[model samples]
Target: MHRLAIALLLIGGAGTAQAAGIRCDGGLVDRGDLQIEVLDACGEPDFRDDWAAGSLPAGVVAPDVTQWTYNFGRGNLLYILRFRNGRVIGIDNDGYGFDADNTSEDCGPTDIVPGMTKYRLLSACGSPAQRDSRVVLRSSRHFRYGVAEQIRRETWIYNFGSRRLLRKVILENGRVVRIDTDNRGFD
Candidate 1:
């Protein structure tokens, strides 16, 4: 480990702390002590772009941003990758036009029904907003202003003999009119 690595590890809080397995040399980013790496078509190069390129810019309204920003045009997409012990733990993808008002509401524990199959849940939600190896839960709320948003919720579910959804749920939101899975699945 070099001084930059050590310094980053020290500055990064213990809360985001991840195992040493994640490369801390130069490819990794230490935030709140959590080791995060963003991967895309270009491969994992040193994270160099200014944070502002995305939603959170330094000294800006956003104080907490975990990933570096990548923009090619209207197709600009922001992503966050979590690593545990140097291996990827989780990945988050966000594109432009993302807004808080249009964000997905938290399902909490009340949203899930045990022994629920992907097929069953898909029917209940009218159609799957999105699906992967994880479970899919989406909700539509119409505000008084006539504006509406579709909140896309994710829970990793497996389709095999076990055929079960994982415990935790990853929740996200998108425009109400544009509710369709972009085919982002672990498979």
Candidate 2:
């Protein structure tokens, strides 16, 4: 009987951890929360991406699985939360966005961080040795059942020379979000 009781306690503990959904700004983004609710609770994330996990037969509506990225700046790990049907389904860090690269630049005794404008980056880096810009569509049905807000987003990449060690910088909507070594080399 004692053994059975111990096993129950272990199972309950595991479930409790899983039940605790995404944590943000001193609050929890629990399951069953609508898209708008998550936004209200967590505010605007550093990045947002929407993708289709699976589709149903023709003439049938498919569920939308969206991923929202929140980067707590330089020294913090990036968090990705997955949502479906306007509710957050899971959260994982399968990808280590904070590349193991140890590159660093003083940039005038200061470091460039998220929220810095593009012009600020250009002035500090004196223009990227290589630059890339692109636009992406951000659409998902995970929005409120009766609401639709499809939009497009822009992202720009700056490579201040591949061998510089302090390689690439990612900017979205005119703000810096990430900076790391150029694992793919300058192209």
Candidate 3:
């Protein structure tokens, strides 16, 4: 029974990894200054919704939405691509670092306040769906439902020296955070 349980866990993990939509063989392109690689492993969508369009080519499977988020200290950038038959159908980019509520303002230095978690920042300023850590701050967020139902995940630089938050970015889910982290602080 224990062995069976272990086997099931392993299978589950593998399935999840397969569903991340990370295709290593695909090409990488620069969208502005950001270079994005669309992986063949485009896994399953976070969840299926009726509002999501089903307009892909007939018989061609839709690769789950693949998300790549980058945090470049001053800004956070996210790319979500939905592919059907190996061609992109949907693409979205939410610039991080900038105030999510405002389109005019680029992300500034004042966004980071100590004691802020990924969730807290989203509550204060929305639109970030995910997050991770780097020299600056990185995170991402995605909402499959609607603006009201947006799911937010976030990560920011927690400087132990200054004991404050700085350069935060948000991404869309749990998987992106794990891949984007460089040095996670103790606290």
Candidate 4:
């Protein structure tokens, strides 16, 4: 009885460590799969973004990270896949999705809030009227060696026509960090 209990606990722990996989067109896309393989299995993603991560030490190269978001419709949750060096490293679920063609009518600028992922913001508010992005590097002394990290900072402006106020969203590393309201929008 003791041995059986120990084996069951080990099995449960192992299961928790495994990454979650997603099903795409009857195919299973899991961690360690190549970018092409996921594209083939899942078809084109609804939205995609690329950024860089990892510590930048002297003469060391940082890994390029790509994130692809798939929206299965209003009934299913959106899945965001992260790839590093052309291989899938993580899969995460955001909020519920909306119809691809009907996305623009789903929500408005008021729905956007801080802590929402880029995918969720896009799903809720559609595309921004204007976008600007830049990389901000900061040094960390906590590491054994001096290292610099690159953070992607983005500013998105939304024009909701003549009635609603304009919104300015600030995102850092693909997550909304702040939102500001500006003057009224134009046609």
Candidate 5:
């Protein structure tokens, strides 16, 4: 029993290490790869988001951050690649991918929830009928001196026809923060 437990622990650690890299077009793209290299290996991603962090000093420029989401297929898991400056910094698995051809109209407004990625929302609910975005400065006590960061906020309004109410999904940075139901939707 002791030997079996040791083996299982080793296997779990190995699985975590393996998740640091992803395969693309017979090539492996790992952390520290350049953005161009990932693009060449993986081709274009299904969804892309670009934003910049706020700097503390007046003359300092914050690095630009980009997130690329790839959905291989229904049988595979969705991957989100985060790039800082021009190099890959991290890779995260969002959720299970769905068939692109069959997902557009398959979900309702209640399917959306906080913390879900925009890529997942798009896959489940399709494009929003209306979209609006703006950048706001938010101050946080976590940082020394309560520094303010410029954050991007977006509102996506989905119309599910007259049968369902309109859903307004609010996103901060790139993740969904809140979901609200408006009045009845149009036909």
Candidate 6:
């Protein structure tokens, strides 16, 4: 493989935090701080926006990015943090943030449940807070090492803040198979 591909593989394989803290409060919130640290520093964002497919600028990687919106009472500039491959790559001041908070205490029901079709799930929850997909090759239970089985796994995250925690929906073969939750509530 080429150098870029190799680097992408290595970076993606590490499975690091997709989003992190915003620079605010006259203090510094640097890139690669992780989601928890971001939450601790920024408190809670007013609203969030996620994009799975879009026109990326030249030389930028596609997919696997989480964008956060923080509105500190409107007078302050809205912070938009973009995390790529598990770390914050850039931070910008978006025009304004929603008056309504995006926290679990504020966000409506996730509308995600087991056995729901991808379409229904998307329609209900919108494009996930963050998305990650991977392919693994392993031998089946038969122990035929030469005959490897391919497994495709996709994980979608919805951050509902501390009240509802974060929801992790796991899918296999384009179908929901399991659901998990954690306190890492920032999507």
Q: Which of candidates 1 and 5 is the stronger one according to TM-score?
A: 5
Q: Whose lDDT is greatest here? A: 4
Candidate 5: lDDT over CA atoms?
Answer: 0.73
Provide TM-scores for the models.
0.21, 0.38, 0.22, 0.72, 0.75, 0.38
Judging by TM-score against the true structure, name the best candidate: 5
* C-alpha-based local distance difference test score of model 4: 0.74
Sort every candidate by TM-score, greatest first: 5, 4, 2, 6, 3, 1
How far residue 22's Cα lies from its native spot in candidate 1, in Å, is 11
What is the lDDT of every predicted structure here?
0.30, 0.49, 0.31, 0.74, 0.73, 0.52
Question: Across residues 1-187, which tens digit of lDDT does each residue of candidate 5 receive?
Answer: 0000000111122111214667776377777999889887778888898875543456645567798877777656667788887898877766556667777566787789898888878778878899987766677876577566767788999998899889999998777899999999989
lDDT of 3 by residue, 119-160 (tens): 324434443323332221122344233212223243533222
lDDT of 6 by residue, 7-77 (tens): 01111211122223344543346666666666666655544444453433354344555666555543444
> Model 5: residues >4 Å from true position, as ranges?
1-19, 52-61, 144-150
Separate clash counts for every candidate: 12, 0, 36, 0, 0, 2
Model 6: CA > 4 A from native: 1-110, 184-187
Candidate 1 minimal-lDDT segment of 10 residues: 1-10
- Residue-by-residue lDDT tens digits, candidate 1, 34-75: 333334222442222111212322343322223332222233
Q: What is the lDDT of residue 164 in candidate 5?
A: 87
Candidate 4 RMSD computed on C-alpha atoms after optimal superposition onto the true structure: 8.6
Question: Residue 178's C-alpha lDDT in candidate 5?
Answer: 95
Q: Candidate 3: what lDDT?
A: 0.31
Tell me the lDDT of model 3 at 87. 48
